[model samples]
Target: MNIINRAASILLLLVFFLAFFQNSVHGRPLLLSMSRPKPDDAALFARWLVSQSSWGVLNTIASDMGGAPFGNVVSFSDGLPDKGHGIPYFYLTTLDPTARNALKDQRSSFTISEYAIGTCGKKDPENPSCAKITLVGKLKVVTEDPKETTFAQTALFTKHPEMEGWPKSHDFQIYKLEIEEIFMINWFGGPKPLTVDQYLQAKMDSHTVIA
Candidate 1:
């Protein structure tokens, strides 16, 4: 073959090999990959924890709370949707004692976990897959204001439709949690858990990037 033709042929082969290698490393077909969990799952789990039980061990500061951290099951509802983000919102009744204490302190953490058993029906505390996610975030009490209350209630009802008929007799107070961090472990075992920023950014970029 002519020199120019030979060089062109080699260049094409190099390009082809490079493309193949890249795809092999990172490309995954939709059918073969795991789909992301829907936002609803997080929302549902958060609401379920609150509605079914007001009891959750609260993680709090020691010196602030009489020099030893405290864990207590407190009744709570989902707060407000995160600013510019649609997240599970929760509300704490103003009349609740725990809510009052949290309001006074203004710093706390809350956790919600699912129940699962090992193959032998034994409770495995070390199971990563069964490990519950505990959200550590800054908390603030939402005092009564008709507009804020309306917005929060609307979001809560939308997420938890079953609570629609519940009597409005309770004086619902709003509490907004700014999620600073989240801890989750993979019980199935794989890579490390993703940071909230990393997870959200990946979702955003994946949707925007061209194939």
Candidate 2:
């Protein structure tokens, strides 16, 4: 009878261990799951992309009168937030073709890439240290909205004081970008993305999970 009792106890212990192992393998811990960003990391990347002025590229898709799309590059200033959306705001003159095109058609996309100072040393194409972040979103041109125009103007002045004459030099207009999606590339040969949310939150929350 004692032997049978011992056997039953061992069977229950085995089942408990198997269940524990399965849960451990498949279940994400509450803390670990919460650490990941809730949604796309656009807000975080936008913040960093705005930090370095010359490190980013603004990609715009515009169309001619025939509706054929063309691309152009324009310097931009980061703008004030519209609640949660990462709306990158900037100013441009109506004389500028890109700005003119944007005024005509507010639907556009902008890409911001990480800039690397080219080195003379042997280059490694596969494993570069730099990371690139591109944000695809809609653009709007505003000429009459005083609040938005003022915000864009202030941001431009703060970033480029030399451009203080922008308001006076031409038919200055403000453009606001409403971010829809973001893409990021980390060329450091890691399986997981070098998450922008992780990067931004790291500045505030030093605790990070190590894989």
Candidate 3:
């Protein structure tokens, strides 16, 4: 009887370990884990994308690729968890082409999809109603000031904890999109006419933007 009990205990432990390994997301917990707002709430929808997403396609004018527009997948953050301020920030290194291109030409746009957030069930990525935002503006490197770096790092590490362990030789630096234009589509009929001010200042809990 003791032998059988020991075997059962070992089996249970193995099951638990297997389950834990399957669920672990790079040894860090996900943040801003929340459901999406209604499609009518444009502000909330935009905020939901910026705050909840861990990465997006950062568009820049490629110098090596015959000056064509280049889009690279990159991780980003605005603020801590749900406290996002609506300005997307990134951690990049010169070793990558996106950072080099941005330095030469600040004109850029960053795009995120609602489908990535899993709110657009059964909808194709090209569907306008599925929701996507392209923030157009200048990509400027953030000042290396200690205070600013700390704030950005805290915001980034909260969501992408694995980033903290990147090799130091790569010289990762903080960059931000100085948004000047907003283009978002969250519902049918047409694209939403949302401005930069309306997007940034839109209260998270308020639904002022009509579909």
Highest-TM-score candidate: 3
Off by over 4 Å in 2: 1-46, 54-56, 65-68, 79-86, 116-129, 143-146, 167-169, 188-211
lDDT of each: 0.48, 0.52, 0.84
Q: State the lDDT at 140 in candidate 2.
A: 75
lDDT of 1 by residue, 1-211 (tens): 6999999999999999986765564432111112223333443223222322222455555444574555655433343222113222455564655566666665667765533111213546565554455667666655567776666667666544545665568765556555677655434553244455643333321222222
User: Clash totals for all models, in order?
Assistant: 11, 0, 0
Candidate 2, 86-193: lDDT as tens digits: 346666676766677766776666655434322113545234334455656667775677877777777666655667775576866667776565565534443234
Stretches off by above 4 angstroms in model 3 are: 1-32, 144-146, 205-211
lDDT of 1: 0.48
Candidate 3 lDDT score at position 144: 64
For residues 1-211, could you state the per-residue lDDT of candidate 3 as single tens digits?
9999999999999999886864574643344355677777777778878887878999999989999999999999998877788989899999999999999999999999876766677999889778899999999899967887788888888778878999999999989999999888888878787778888887875433222
Q: Let me know the TM-score candidate 1 reaches against the reference structure.
A: 0.49
RMSD per prediction, one decimal? Answer: 15.5, 17.7, 5.7
Question: What ranking of all candidate models by lDDT puts the best one first?
Answer: 3, 2, 1
